[model samples]
Target chain A: DQQVKQNSPSLSVQEGRISILNCDYTNSMFDYFLWYKKYPAEGPTFLISISSIKDKNEDGRFTVFLNKSAKHLSLHIVPSQPGDSAVYFCAASAINNDMRFGAGTRLTVKP
Target chain B: DVKVTQSSRYLVKRTGEKVFLECVQDMDHENMFWYRQDPGLGLRLIYFSYDVKMKEKGDIPEGYSVSREKKERFSLILESASTNQTSMYLCASSYPGTSGFSSYNEQFFGPGTRLTVL
Candidate 1:
């Protein structure tokens, strides 16, 4: 069974607009959540993260929102740039365990 | 800067062949992981090592084995290469959390190796 899921396979948005990518998890023990971005042929790089105790965390143009009650989380990228196009993966981990990754959503920011 | 390096960027092998994928990290991280990424399947962990000579199986461990003989090196071995094993292999390393960054789960990844089995 997949503990984490990204229902949307892809998302497209205009440059300078806000792009929202959503994720859901079935495991409640997950206390740490993270987002990673991957370009074609390259490995994934850490983008941003939010702890379960907090509802939101922001880093410059990127923000991650976590709703523990709803078992959902979303990654918001404001002023999405053409360079922001890549495969975005949602990952979560429980205390004292390895992390699990979602299927990933390809986000394309058109100019 | 933290750096993780993989031995190869691409490789092609015939079925029933033995294959080895090597990964090295300069970050001196305590944990090292080997994962395979497939289209629509996401990243699936094959194996991981937390200490030298210590290893653990991840979500998919069949037909895969790992060795951590040195602190900076982790090696994944395929006893017999199969078509189903063909995928992009990725290596990642991470250290135990510090203070405020309680989510020290941030892992640095090496450029992946795309392997193909004939």
Candidate 2:
């Protein structure tokens, strides 16, 4: 069974627009959520993250929102640039447990 | 900066052959992980090591074994390569997450090795 899932396989947006990527989880024990951005052949880079205690966390143009009650989280990027195009993965983990990753959503920002 | 390096960018092996994939991390991390990424399956952990000589099987560990002789290097061995095992292999490293109720450590991954078993 998949504990974490990214329902959307891909998302596209225009430059300078907002891009939203959603993720859901079935495990209630997960207390921390993170987003990672991956280029074509490179490893994934850490993006923003949020603790379950907080509803939202923002870093520069990236913002991550967590809803514990709904078991869902979303990453928002404002003024999305072409460089923002890549695969986004949502990961969640509990204390002492290995992180579970979503299938990843490919984001493409057009000029 | 944390850097994880894999032994190869691509490898092709025949069935029944023994294959070894090596990974090295420069950050002196205590945790190392091996995962296989497929088109729709994303990334699935094959094995992980918490310390030198200590290893744990992840969700999928069949036909795979791992070794961590040194703190900086981890090796994944395929007992007998199979066609189904062809996929992109990824290596990751992270610090030990000992905090109670919070295992929020971020993992640094390698560029990945594409392995093809024919």
Candidate 3:
């Protein structure tokens, strides 16, 4: 069974527009959620994260919203640029360990 | 900055060959993990070690083994490599207790190793 799911396999956005990527989880035990960004030929880098206790977390141009009631989370990038185009992954962890990752959403920001 | 170094950037081996992928971290972190990345599958954990000589299987540990004899090093071993095993391997390290800026669990990942089993 997939505990974490990213239904959208790909997303396309125009430059300077906003890109929103979604993720959902089935296990309620997950309390920590993290997002990672990856470019071609490189490993994923940490992007942003939110805890179950918080509803939203923002970092620079990126913001993450978490709705525990819906068991869903989303990453929002305002003024999306071509450089922001890449694959994004949402991961969850319970017991402060054993992270579970989603399949990933490939975002293409057209210039 | 936390530096996690992987031994290989790309490797090619034949089926039934024993493969060893090594990872070293200089951050002195207590937790190390190994994961495989595929096209449709993001990243799946194979194994993790919280301390020396201690290991735990993750979501997908079949056809894989691990060794951690020291605090800064973790190794993933493929007993017999299969073509299906060809994928990008990633190693990550983090401070064991918590994650993120406020007592969090942010992991630092190596560049990655792309392995091809022919």
lDDT tens digits, residue span A16-102, model 3: 999999999999989989999989877789999998999999999999999999999999999899999999999998765588899
- Weakest ten-residue segment in model 1 chain A by summed lDDT: A93-102
Task: List each candidate's DockQ score.
Answer: 0.53, 0.63, 0.50
The CAPRI-style docking tier of model 2 reads: medium
What lDDT score goes with residue A55 in model 1? 99
lDDT (0-100) at residue A55 of candidate 3? Answer: 97
| Tens-place lDDT digits, model 1, residues B39-117 | 8889989998877898989999999999999999999999999999999999999986654112247888999999999
**Positional deviation of residue B80's Cα in model 2 after best superposition, in angstroms:** 0.3
TM for every model, in the order presented, reads 0.97, 0.97, 0.95
Highest DockQ against the true fold, candidate: 2
Tens digits of lDDT, candidate 1, A1-111:
889999999999999999999999999999999999999978899999998999999999999999999999999999899999999999999766778999999999999
Residue B27 CA displacement from its true place in model 3, Å: 0.4
- What is the lDDT for B43 in model 2? 83
* Worst 10 contiguous positions by lDDT, candidate 1 chain B: B96-105
